[model samples]
Target: MNYLETENNTKITHFVLVGVSGQPHLQIILFMLGLVMYLITVIGNTLIIVVIILDSRLHTPMYFFLSNLSLLDICGSTTTAPQSLINCLQDYPIISYNACYAEMGISLCLGVTECFLLSVMAYDRFVAISSPLRYMVIMNKAVCLGLTGISWTIAFLTSVIPMLVTPVNFCGHNVVNHFACEMQAVLKLVCSDTSTSLVLLFVGSIFTLVIPFSFIIISYLRIVVAVLNIRSTEGRLKAFSTCGSHLTVVTIYYGTLIYMYVKPQTRESEDKDKIISIFYGSVTPMLNPLIYTLRNKDVKGALRKIAGKSKA
Candidate 1:
């Protein structure tokens, strides 16, 4: 492994990222692939955000939350893609200590926020199905704002606090074995005692992953029960159609995330981790807009209307 000369204090100044591949040719291939996906992610999500804002027909509780998710996808992709793609071009790509920390912090915050937000979305679907008349009343502007605000606060508390509270010594290892400064990957380089940091992170993962995921499952189960109570097949189909996209996205996103964490990390599994990271970090974000838009009649109608207006 290539390394930089250490300072007298052995204070780590920067980190050399091994990136996806050590081979220059392979790195270039990955870089091109990541660039195309990143562009698609940005454009697709941006279109969703724009449609949600412009189409008065879509100005509802569901679309409101969806717009926020689109924004998050854009931001999440941005958090990791630029640096990773750039690093792919160089053999020894280095990130400043502060920048690496910032990357990890932003990724963690966004990840936690998405977890809670998805649960809230599942609840929204449940309310919409279980109590159609009261859905608007229950999920009013004030209520939606409150829910999203709580999620953001939870994210900040869970992500930011742990980073600040549990300071770890890196000793002399400044080599990150991944394309991005992922939390788990960086934590592996800690040369000091990691009991506090590991525990804190583990607890935060529970709040962000296990708890939210459980809530989503319960919400969907209730939604299923409510849909089953519908007398007409069309009614049930309509209800299912409304939330099918969300369920698909949940399966793709959470499925990858759960798989990423369930196994113990071994030397052999580190590459697997890298592969999973790229999938969730970039592929999921790229697919979100597609998943939400392709099956959504409301979104498609809105897009068509926007297109007509532009042509006129």
Candidate 2:
């Protein structure tokens, strides 16, 4: 390990975030773009949460879970985007070590929580379609809150444990090769052997990503079967409609996540990883509310009512 020796013989306290681009013009462009996306993400997710809360028609298990998902999206984007945007505009692009770790922890927690929440949502859809009469009874308020609590608890534990246990020795190299404090990029700076941390991270990824993804797939498969069994055309259409927005969000969310984490990392792939991270962490949140509202008639109606009331 190449430890640094300062004038007073101490280690560096901060890290340089080598953002997406080194060129000044490119950095400015990225800053502007990131800012726009961040604003949209916050506003859009907030709107979803507000709509769900204000509208009595949306007071069902589905919308309740959707509101939770929106909140997670907001938190996820907030964790990375603000720091990234600031870094983009700065000449030194520096972050304190503790701040970087905090960012990583919060980002991971929100992301893992979203993964489990999405699977729970898939189950909600399955129950709604597979057993319509008992949907309310099955997914009562207590059960919904319990499921959300479990997701948050598991996510926080998984995220915090590895952060606390993992050994991160920056040595002399304190430059991170991406905008945000991404796990892989940060790990690359470690001077010590990171085999244990790597193993733990892999196991955590399996629990947070692969297992939940498999559950979503299985739930959707059953949903497809049930939807097909509907005798009437309108019935089949309604069932598919209910799952379509969720399916789209899941595909986009998991696609970026799988590409970012599941693939082999190499020198050439680092840039690609950052881009995909931005997609899931920033762009996806902004798009989610649009996907749900544009596709969902109930949400549209609620928006209309809200707008009409304001006009009056």
Candidate 3:
């Protein structure tokens, strides 16, 4: 089908999403996998939020930030995973132009928010380890709330310009070469000049990806120094233990994101890129709560408590 202009003069009404694979057998496998991941992502993240809220022991700055991260993971996975799964079942998966833009905007906002949240979490760790006596005062309730609010506000604002500008310019092309309306994938479908959008996206990427990553690195460096200064091996191990989960999460999240967005794209790498995107978008969210719960004694204890209470 050819692209047609709407009454309002918009060039594209709908877009066909060429999902990760074209083969029917692969699509079936991908759909089942995506469905399973989506279920786990929602259930795991929701469990984290519930555990933190219900467990008095978890009512701390760290878990507070963790709850927010869980929320982001939920939103992030919901933004694309369901649609991707649905597309896998359809012969020609199409999304309305408006819906595509909305998906792109929300996904971008959530992605940026996660970046800021991770950096904030890193800083929280730094304060906790480096200045234990003052950690409470430093990461007070007001400050924690402020940090969370700032992350959401800045992320939404950063995505607003691109969301407003990009859809207005998509002219002839109406086929997105991915499972969902990923920003870059959707942008690739626009026939009109997207130089301004691309530039703005680059600037946003710098703030969202580069700056937050740098902050995480700096915070970890200080944390490492502080851990090294501890007198005993037990003390050092305990300090590092607290940081282990966050570092693992940060490495996985940023590593995949950098590879997905920071690296240049080529035709040959598009399929691999889509696969990586799936890993980060759907799989990572599902893994986050598992990572935190498995590595952190507090979370496990809370889960056990909750399980016992239910049994009682």
Candidate 4:
């Protein structure tokens, strides 16, 4: 039975997910990998949030932002991971039009928020290093909340506003060359003129990715200058250590994104980029907790404190 209500041009009621590939072996491997990534992301991010909340010693602005980052990672991975996993197991798994757009909007919102959050974190670090005594006063509760709230608001506006202004006109049974409604895959299926949407996307990318990335770079440069002025070698090491995790994360995240975004995506590129997309979208989230906690004495101390209390 044909479910689609067609006009002269067949209206796209749904989309088909092309998992990593049509081959059964590849599909199985992709499903296993995606599922593992989703589980790891959920578990790692949740643990970070739990530790941050329970440990009073971690009640600083840096940890506070870290908690929010964990939350965003959890939500961002969830926005598409489950559906992608299901599509890997099912042949040509279909998603309704509304559901696909909803996924895109939610994920895009989270991505934009993360960009702003990372920039905010870089600023936080700069302030801490550059003005240690006044750090708390500068990054007070009100300021933290205000910055976080603004990031979410900007994210929401950026993700939804342009979409409302210029909606994509998709053709029938759009076989999205992806396991989820990735922006590129969805864009490929648009039946109408997309010059306007492309232009809007370019403008949006400038603000969402390029601008924030520039801010982070500038913030870190100042941080580097501040750290170099420290009289004590130990103080310099401590300052660099404080920033090491964030810098590592920033490099991996931005490197993958810049490479992915700049390349001209083709049919083959869509399939080829699945792992790259998954690496940024899921693997990074999973790695964040490990990155932030593994070598950090503060997080280790907090975990030990919690463990000791639980034992008692």
Model 4 pairs whose backbones collide? none
Tens-digit per-residue lDDT, 132-193, candidate 2: 99999999999999999999999989987768765566667778888888887887877666
lDDT of each: 0.84, 0.85, 0.84, 0.83
Clashing pairs in 3: none
Per-candidate TM-scores read 0.94, 0.94, 0.93, 0.94
Off by over 4 Å in 3: 1-10, 166-168, 265-269
Candidate 1 per-residue C-alpha lDDT over 23-79 given as tens digits, one digit per residue, 9 for 90 to 100: 988898898999999999999999999999999999999999998998998999998
**Span of ten consecutive residues with least summed lDDT in model 1:** 1-10
lDDT of 1: 0.84
Off by over 4 Å in 2: 1-9, 265-269
Clashing pairs in 2: none
Ordered list by lDDT, greatest first: 2, 1, 3, 4
| Shift in Å, residue 20, candidate 2 | 3.4
**TM-score for candidate 3:** 0.93
For 236-293, candidate 4 gives per-residue lDDT tens digits of 9988987988988887787777666655544342555666787679878988998898
Q: Count of backbone clashes for each model?
A: 0, 0, 0, 0
